[model samples]
Every structure is written in structure tokens, then in C-alpha cells.
Target chain A: MIPYLACVLLFLIGLYVVISKRNLIKIVIGFSLIEYAVNLFFALVGFKKGALAPIITQPEQVRMGVARNFVDPVPQALVLTAIVIGLSTTALMLSLAMRLYEKYKTFDISEIRRLKG
Target chain B: MEGRILPLFVAIPLAGAFLVPLLSKLWTRFADLIASITSALLLGVSVYGWLMVNAGGMPLHYWVGGWRIIGIAMWFDALTALIVLIINIVGFCASVYSIRYLDRYTGGRWKFFTLLLLLIAGLNGLAISGDLFNMFVFIEISAIASYALVAFGTEEEEVEAAFKYMVLGEVGGAVLLFGIALIYARASTLNLAHLSQVLAGFGRTPFYWFVIATLLIGFAIKMGMEPFHAWLADAHFSAPAPISAMLSGVFIKVTGVYAMSRLMFNVFGVSRAETPAFFNLLIAFGAVSMVLGGLLAYTQNDYKRLLAYSSISQIGYILVALGIGNFWGIAGALFHILAHALGKGTLFLASGSVERQTGTRNLEQLKGLEKTMPATTWSHILASFSMAGLPPFAGFFSKLFIIIGAIAARMYWLAFLAALFSAVTLGYLTKVVNMAFFVKQNSSVTSTREAPGLMVLAMLVLVVLTVAVGVGFRGVLDHLVGPAARVLLNGLEYARLVLGG
Candidate 1:
């Protein structure tokens, strides 16, 4: 329960950084932190006490409390997909940040106001 | 055979996208021809699907690997059918327009078409997929393709805009995924039908409310709902013309609006008791976006930027209508989606032509184009009038239905505000007409000529569609929009349709 609370705290921290940070790179890091927190939450949801990996090797072993031992594999699978998507998004965002740096010679989003009301 | 053809809607585009780069190595024109043919074929299939759904009640669901429940399921209902029509129709026209318009861009026609095809595949897949996680996957596919397309020009501004779009869009995607995860944890299923059944049985809990909140925020950001709409204008402005048409016309609607509506109405079951709060929130957001987008558009010199802001406003009407949550309200929302898709698409393509000829999109720098480019001028006038809700045009019917829906719901003030915003919409569109067509030419635009024949043909087709929908609106309301609206009006009916008796 405490770990779950900590995970929520971490997510809030990342959200704060993303909203408050001015530097483009820092903002990206903030986003990454939030992503990590979500990923952690997903993994935690699938956790079980004294659980083995969800592998079916032997019928005899399965008969011996297998259901009680194996953690849920579905959320882990989902988190894996989420991680790949996050990697792609982060890489694309960082490359764009690099390009923005080249154009404006700065990383502050406020300074990058070629577009505004 | 019915099920077999359904997968082809996605498969053909996916295969074409994969083969594009290889084909481009052989010949430059090969990529264009392949994409054009693929989209054209998809357009025909979507129309067929529309007719099939209209003639036959209920949706068509196809299960991959035979009829196993665990395998992939693609369900096409009236709502999905409506969105599919929008996607394939706009996609076909955009591909035709791109043939000539894209010549201005740099290399790899194959890559461009590949991305376009992938985007189309993603959208069709999202529209049909019955599973929540599958929808997310397809949404990512479309979002990534759009991000690449936005940066296709590789100009400084294009790259910057694409970057900003990626950052915000990625956050929205993450939020969506997180929401999905939470729902999965509670419901222990990802199939939308199954999940909704479980949720209905469990009733609304605090956890359910949390999931709903997260999902709404995530989808709202993607839809460019007010307050979360910062990325829309820049991304639309930076993307190429045909891509702009797709982005503004179909993509946002599929990923954002359609997904939101499906979730809220069908999956979550926003009943009459709960709907008032939902409607109020939607109206508040919609009104703000309507007024804000129009006011912002009036100050824009760049034509595409102005159009982009205008799209934000136009989309707000759909949201407002959906919020009203009545039979006529939903009918108006769906009708408005169709009308806006046609009208805004025409305007974007027309702006492209004017830019291609005049070598600029600045309103102040473009003038007296009616004599110089009669086709573009006429298309602009027709589309702009339709957008402003002029009588005997598609937009007029949609706006009228929405107002009627508001009145039916006894939201007199909301109806009045919608009418007020319609006038504001008229004001901006009239300004566009006077500056681009009626006024004296700026010295810079002396060398401008009419757009290419193919581009003009595309715009004309959209104009014709707009007119057809306007004049033949009763048929549309009876056959297409009514059935679709019924699906939303009775949310419990969706569960029965999907899960069987």
C-alpha cells in the first residue's frame, strides 16, 4: 500500500516538473518520469505474493498451487508495449528538441513563441 | 465473404504502406498510382459498407482466426460505418489532390504514400476494433504516421511544429494508456463489449469515476477540445496540404471525437440522470472553444493557420451537440461531423491551391482571385458559406439541427449562444472571401494562376458532396444519421448488439 502511494507521489512529481519546467530537455525528462511512474503502476498491479512467472512447464507442478504462485502476466505484456511506444515518442521528441535548439539557440518554451495568440 | 472484406479495409492499406518504399525504388510515379488506387478502392468499400449497414440492421463483426472470442474482433456498427465513410471519402480525395500538390515537396513519394496508407489503415482499424487495447495500438499507428507527415517538409517551422505536436500528443497517448490500464485492472478485460458488460454489472464505483475522468481528459486532448487545443493549429499549419485536409477533416474526429463518444455513450452508459452534468460540461467547453477559435482566427494572416483555428471552432459544435445527449442532438452531431469534414476539407484544399499558385497563404497578400482562379474562388465561396451555416448548404442543416436539439432539451440560452457564434463564424468567413477574392490584388500576387486541374477536381467533388448532403439532407437524416443517432440514444442497445442476447 505504501509503495502504491509512493508511485502516485512520483507521478505527481513528474507532472509538476512537466508543467513548471521551462527548459525543453527538462520537460522531456519530466514526461519520461511520468511515463515511468505509469509503467511502474502497471507492473505493480500484476504483482502477487510469492509468485512465479506465468510459465506452464509441467502439469504436476501446475497442480501444486500454481494459481497461488503466478503473478498476472497481462499487465507486464501491456507495460512492455507501452515501453516501446514511450521509447519511440521520447526519441522523436528529443530529436525535435534538438532541431528547436538549432533554430532558436535555446530550450525555453516561452522563448520559442513564433506561434501565439 | 462479409467478414472477409472487413479486414481488407485495413490489410490493403497496411500492405500498400509496407510495399511503397520498395515500389518507389522502381519508379517515382509507381507510389502515387498505388496509393491512389488503394484509397479509391477503400472508398468504394466504405460506401458499400454504409449501404449494407443501412439496408440491414445491426453492425457487422468479424473475428480473426475464426469466431474465437480471444482473437481479434473488428466490429462495424452504424457509428463506425459513418466514420469509415468520412475517412475513406476524405482519404480518396486527399490522395487525388496530393498527386499534383505533393510535387513541391522533396523525395520519396513512396514514403509519403506509405505513411498516408498507414495512417488510413490505423484509422480504419481504430474505427472497427472492438477491443480497448487494440484501439490504443491503432491510435498510436495513426499518431506516429501523422507526426512523421507533419515533419515531412523538414523545414525549420515544420520540424518545430511536428516536435510540439509530438510532445503534447505523446502526453495524451500516455494518459490514454494509463486510463486503459486502470480500467483493465478493475474489469480484467480489454474487449470493449466485455468490459462494458462487467462495468455495468459492477455498477459505478469511485474507481470507475477515476477511469472515466482519465479517459475523458486523454481523449479530449487528442480531439483538440478547449484548453487542450494548443497543438492543433501549429500541426495543421505545418503539415502538407493533403495531410492538412486529412488531419483537419478525419483524423481528429476518429481518434478524438468518435472514440470519446463511443466510450461515453456506449461503453460507460451516460444515462438521462447522469447526462445533464455531462451536457453542461460539454456546452461550457464547446462555447468557449467556439468563441475563442473564431476570435483567434480573425487575427490570422496565414490562411492555413486561420483554417486550423476555424476547425477548432467547428469541432466544438459537434461536442456541444453530443453533450446535449438527445436523439436530435446526436443526429445533429453526426450530421455536423459529415458537413464539417466536407466543408473544412474543401477549404483546406482550396487554400493549398491558392498557396500553390500565389506562392503565399497570407490573406493580406492575396486579392482579386475570382477572375484569376474561378474554380478556387467558387469552391471557397461554397465551402465558406457552408461553414458559416448559410441556408441551403450542408452546414446550415447541421447547425439548425443542433439548435433544435438544444431547444428540445430546453437549453434556450445554449441555443441562443450557438446562433451568436454562427454569426461570428460568418464574420470571419466573409472577411476571408473579401480579402482573397473580392478585393484588389496585392502587388505580390500578380503571377498567381489557377490551381492544377486535379486539385480543382478534388475541391469540386467535395463541393458537390456538400451540396448533395445539403439538398438531400432528409435522406441522410432518415437513412444514415438516424440509425447512428439511435445507437447513442439507447446506450443499452449497444451492449445487446455487441454481446448478443
Candidate 2:
């Protein structure tokens, strides 16, 4: 329960960084942090006490087994997809940051005010 | 055979998108022909689907890997039908417009066509997918394609705008995925129909409310609703003009407004007694976006940027209408979605022509275009009046329905505010028309000839539709918007259709 609360706190911190930080790279990092926290939360949801990975090997053992210990594979699968999406988004954002740096020569979003009202 | 056509709407575009680059190597012009043919086919399929669904009297669901609940499914109903028609029609028009507009961008025509096709496929897939996870995949596909298109120019400003768009959009996606995971964790299902069934019996809890809030915020960002709309103006202004029309006219509507309506009304059962707060929250958000976006547009100098802000404002009106949560409001929202897409798309395409001819998009530099390019000027005038909600124009009736709906819901203040914002919208658009067409033309632009014939023709068709819809407003309201509204107002009927009574 405490760990779950900690995950929520971490997510809030990341959100704060994303909303308050002015540096483009920092904002990206903040986004990554939020994603990591969510991924962790999803994995936690699937965790079971003394649970083993859900894999079937050895027909004899599987026949005798009571199936008391198997982690939820669905959340794991979901997290895997989330991680891939996060990686692609991060890479794309970083490249865009590089381009922005070349154009503005500054990482500060305040200086990127050529568009605001 | 019925289900077969459902998948074609998505599959054709997906196939065309993947084949374009490969075909481009063999024949340089292959991409253009393939894309045009694919969109025209999609338009035909969507119209056919609409007719079949109207006659058949229920949404169509197609199972991807056979008729099992666990396999992927595509559901088509009145709502999806309306959205699919909007997407394919605007998509066809934009693809046609892009044939010439994209010539301005040197090289990478193949890449541009590929991305545009992929975006269309994503939107179509998003509209029809019956499962939550599949919706996420389609949303990403669309988002990634749009990010690339926003930076298509590869200019410094374009890259910067794309960067901002990516950062905000990625955050929204992440938030949405997290919400989806939470919902799945609680309900133990990813199919929207199954999830809603499980959720209905779960009773109200803080956890469910938390998930609802997260989903709403995430989707709201995509919709370009207020407080999360910072990225929209930049992305819309930086993309190529036809792409801008796609983003503002259809993409935001599909991924944002349509998704929100589905989740709130159909999936979450926000009409339940305990969820009145959620409805109020939506109304408040809609009001903010309406007032703020209009005020922001009044201050813009750049032509595309002004249109971008106006897109935000117009979407606000739709949100407000939907937020009212009545038959009339829902109908008005749907009508506004179609009306805004046609009006704004024509204006954006015209902006492209104006930019190409004068080589500038600044309002101060672009004056008396009516004399210079009469056809483009007339299209712009017609679209502008429509946008400002003037009488005898499509925008006017849509806004009227929204206001009347608001009043019927006993939200008199909101109705008055919506009307006031219409006037504010008129103020900004009138300024644009006066400065760009009515004022004296700068010496440099005086010699500029009319836009290309194809561009003029495209704008004329949209103008005609805008006028026709306005003139025949009652008929459209009776047939299209009214039926779509009935689907939402009768949300339980949706569950009956999906779950089979």
C-alpha cells in the first residue's frame, strides 16, 4: 500500500515538473518519469504474493500444480506496449528538441515565445 | 458481406499508406494516384455504410480474428457513421487539395502521401474499434503521423512547433494509456462493451471517479479544450495548409470531441444521478474554451495562426453543446462538427492560395485580395460568414441549435454566453475580412493572379455545401443530426445494440 502511495506521489512530482519546468529537455524528462511511474503502478497491480511468472513447462509439474502462484500476464503485456510507445515518443521528442536547439540556440521555453499571444 | 465492408474503411487506407513508398521508387507519380483512388474509395465505402446502417437500424460490428469476444472488433453505429463520413469526406477533399499544395514542398512527396494515408487509416480505425487497446494503437498511429506532418516543412519554426506538439501530445497519450490500464485493472476487460457492463454494476467509488477524471483530462487535451490547448495554435499554424485543415477540421474532432462523447455518454454512463458533477465539469470546460479561444483569435496577425485559434473557439461551441446533454444539444454539436469542418477547411485552403500568391500570411501585408483573386476572395467571404454564425449560413443554425438546446436545459446563462461569444467571433472574423479583402491591396500583391483552378474548384464545392446545408437546414437537422442525437440520448439503447437485447 505504501509503495502504491509512493508511486502516486512520484507521478504527481513528474506532473509538477512537466507543468512548471521551462527547459524543453527537462519537460521531456518529466514526461518520461510520469510514464515510468504509471508503468510501475501497472506492474504492481499484477503482482501477487509469492507469485511466479506465468509460464508452463514440465507437463508433470503442471498436472500436479494447484496454480497458486502466477502473476497477471495481462498487465505485463500492457506495460511492454506502453514502454515501447514511451521510447518512441521520447526519441521523437528529443530529436525535435535538437532541432529546436539549433533554431533558438536555447533550451528555455521562455525564449521560444515566437508563437504566444 | 455486411461485416466485410466495415474493415475495408480502415484496411484500404492502411494498405495504400504502406504501399505508397514502395510504389514511389518504381514510379514517381504512383503515390499521388494511389492516394487519390484510396480516399475516393473510402468516401464511397463510408457513404454506403451510412446508408446501410440507416436502413438496417443498428450499428455494425465486425470481428477481426473471428467472432470471439477476446478478438479485436470494429463497431459501426450512427455516431461512428457520422464521424466516418466526416473523416472520409474531408479526407478526400484534403487529399485532392494536397495534390497541388504539396508540390510546394521540395522532395519527399512520397513520404507526405504515406503519412497522410496513415493518418486517415488511424482516424478511421479509431472511429470504429470496439476495444480500448485498439483505440490506443490507432490514436498513436494518428498522433505519430500528425507529428511528422506538422514538421513536414522541416523549417526551423515548423520543427519547433512540432516539438511542442509532440511533448504535449505524448503527455496526453501517456495519461490516456494509464487511465486505460487502470480501468482494465478494475473491470478485468478491455472491450468497451464488456467493460461498460462490468462497470455498471460496480457502484460509484473514488477509484472510478479518479479514472474518469484522468481519462477526461487526457482526451480533453487531444480535443484542444481550454487549459490544455497551448500546443494547438503552434501545430496548426506550422503544418502545411491542407494538413492544417485535416488537423483542425477532422483530427481534433475524431480524437478529441468524438472520443470524449463516447467515453462520457456511452461508456462511463455519465448521465447517472451520481455523475451530475461530471456533466457540470464538462459544461464549465466548454464555456472556458469558447470564450478564451475566441478572444485569442481576435489578437492574431498571422493568417494560418488566426485560423488555428478560431478552430479552437469553434470546437468550444461543439463541446458546450454536447455538454448540455440533451437531444437538441447533441444534434447541434454533431451539426457544428460537420459545419465547422466544411467552413474552416475551405478557409484554410484559401489561406494556402493566398500565401502562395502573395508569399505572405500576415494580415497587414495581405489587403484587397477581393480585387486580386476574386474567386478565392468570394470563398473566403462565404466561409468567414459561416464561421461567425451569420444568418442564412450553416454556422448560424448550428449555433442557434446549441443556444436553444442550452436554454431548454435551463442553462440560460450558458445560452446567453454562447450567443455573446458568437458576436465576439464575428468581430475577429470581420476584422480579418476587412483587412484582407476590403482594405487596399499592397503594391506587391496587386499583380497576383487568381489561384490555381483546382484549388478554386475545391473551395467552391465546400462553399456550395456550406450554403446548401444552411438553406436546407431543416432537412439536414431532421435526417442526419436528429438520428445521431437519438443514439446518444438513448445511451442504454447503445448497450442493447452492442450486447444484443
Among these predictions, the greatest DockQ belongs to 1
Per-candidate TM-scores read 0.96, 0.94
lDDT of 1 at B1: 46
Tens-digit lDDT track for model 2 on A23-94? 999998998999999889888888888889988877876688857478888888878988887887788888
Q: What is candidate 1's local distance difference test score?
A: 0.86
For candidate 1, lDDT tens digit of each residue in B1-501? 465568988998888888888888889898889899999999888888888887777588788877555667778888888899999989989989999998787776778899999999999999988888889888988998999899888777888788778877878887898898788878778777777788888777777778888998888888888898889999999899889999999999999999888888888888656656776788788888888888888788788999999999988899888888888888999999999999999999999998888788888887788888999989989998999899899999999999999999999987998888889888888888888887574434633578889999999999999999999999988988888888877886776777782
lDDT for model 2: 0.86
For model 2, the superposed segments whose C-alpha errors exceed 4 Å read A20-23, A58-69, A106-108, B272-274, B439-447
Interface RMSD of each: 1.5, 1.5
Local distance difference test values of all predictions, in order:
0.86, 0.86
lDDT of 2 at B226: 91
